[model samples]
Target: MEIAVCRAADVALLDECIGSPGAVSSHARRFARQGEGGGTYLVAWIDGRPVGHAEVIWDGCAAPEVRAALPGCPELNGLGVWPPELRSRGIGGALIRRAEELAREYGRTVLGLGVAADNPRAADLYARLGYRRLTDYVDRWSYEDRDGVIRECVDPCTFLTKELPSGSLDVKRT
Candidate 1:
């Protein structure tokens, strides 16, 4: 699999394959086409097909509490893999590793990410990638679904932060 920053032309195919699990279909269009934010979407492709994706939020943590706690620490958010069978095959981890590299390129020393409190598998994955829990908080957000209906999400999350090393591109896993 190859990880690359998403291009505008890739959005439609990405959506057709991934279908936005967290009401983030808009984001694929946003970053991939509009380039509205400081961050970008890193896409995982295999055999010329988009398989996974994650966002590098250069501005830092999206959660207010996490932002206040770790100011200016860019975040890796909205990670997902396409086709349930493709999960657990290191796609998510590779996207995260590429995000870290992008953060370093931006001269950032640390990166932060939030994991839903109930998802132990993800927490374990982040831990193996060298992220340590900093605090827990209610992650609240609202989004407009495909039907244009406003949805409220109030998830309890554990915010984690990792110090990106200046050297070595290998992602640590244990």
Candidate 2:
């Protein structure tokens, strides 16, 4: 598979990939187009078709809460892979490795990410990549439907931080 930065044209495809039932959330359009403080985004193409993707953001500031929990620099957020089929194929790890590369380019010494607590697979993947658990918090929000009826949802967010080396961090299934 070939991996490359996602372009605006890939939004629809990425949306399709990330919006599948098993995913925690689907916000592909935001990453596909990018905004100020854009971090890094990549897509894995298999047989010339987009099959997997990862999106991330860097604000140059580690969240105060995350910093209080661990020693690290630079806030990283929104890293995810698309398509349930690509879960264990190393696509997510590669995307993170690329993000670390960008972090170093920005003169950062540490990188961090937030994963939902329910996602043990992602937590294990990050651990194997040398990311140590820094802190855990709950993300609670409300969503409104067409009628303005709001629904509440709560999810545990685990923040993991890692010091980057010169090479890609190796990740393994746990």
Candidate 3:
């Protein structure tokens, strides 16, 4: 298995993993628009097949309240491991660790992520990984569906944060 940052050449493989060509194109565009201090996508591959992904957003997009509570923390968003059978294989954890590495590369000392209030399983996993709830937040965003129709979403979530140890970029994955 290989975990690495996604590049332009990985679009088709990402599309295959995500099962949405439009979404892949959108991600590709976002990756291209990223500047020197911007964010990028990370993908996990097994046997040359993409299986998981996450986004390391340098410009944290947390709500104002959450942002004020934990300033200067980059966000790890859109983390997913494809197909039900792939769960518990550590792909998600690996992707998250990669996000932390990317955050460290950006000179950030903290990382943040939002979990749906109802998702205890994910919240538990985050807690076990040392993330603590900072505050409640609402995630407002929009995206185009596979049919090119735009949809808006507002999720009630809990903002969680983890302080990264300085100079710990070389921390090994468990």
Candidate 4:
């Protein structure tokens, strides 16, 4: 599988293949954000199909607290793997490694991400990827759905960061 910055066409396919209308709108917005230099929206593909995704926020995180606390650290945001059955096949890990590689390319020494407090599984993934807890924060963000309606979200999250100077993703797969 190859991981690369998502394009508008890829976002359209991602939306149709794995998302709802709202998600389509969100993905489109992410695509726009990428164009504006806000972040790098990454998509992983297998056999010409999109399978996984992750975003690296070049400026910082959406959470205000995290931004203030970890200045200059790029965020690994909105990570996901499509088609639940396809999970645990290393797609997600590949997305993460790609994100880390981008961070290194940008001269960033640290990369951070937030795992929802309720999702220990994702937290474990981050831990195994060399991320350690930094703090807890309420993740808040809003987005415009397909119908042009704005939606809000608030989730409890544990912020984690990893030093990206030099590390190999050789942690044993469970």
Highest TM-score against the true fold, candidate: 4
* Order of candidate numbers by TM-score, starting with the best: 4, 1, 3, 2
- How well does candidate 1 match the true structure in TM-score terms? 0.88
The runs of at least 3 residues in candidate 2 whose Cα sits more than 4 Å from the true structure, single-residue gaps closed, are 20-29, 60-64, 67-72, 141-152, 166-174
Q: Which window of ten consecutive residues has the lowest lDDT sum in model 1?
A: 25-34
Candidate 3, 73-125: lDDT as tens digits: 78888888888699788888888887887777778889999999788878988
- Top lDDT prediction, candidate number: 4
TM of each candidate vs. truth: 0.88, 0.72, 0.88, 0.89
What are the lDDT scores of the predictions, listed in order?
Answer: 0.82, 0.64, 0.79, 0.83
The residue-by-residue lDDT of candidate 1 on 1-174, one tens digit each, is 899888878888887877754456754654743287767788899999888888887786667788778888887888888887998999998898888888877888998889998899999999999999888888887777867788888999999999988875665421
- TM-score of model 4 vs. true structure: 0.89
> Of 2 and 3, which scores higher on TM-score?
3
Better by TM-score, candidate 3 or 1? 1
Question: Which consecutive 10 residues in model 4 have the weakest lDDT in total?
Answer: 165-174
**Which regions of candidate 3 deviate over 4 angstroms?**
20-26, 33-37
- Residue-level lDDT of model 2, residues 10-93, one tens digit each, is 666766655532223234544633544455666667776676665555553344566577544555555555557667887777
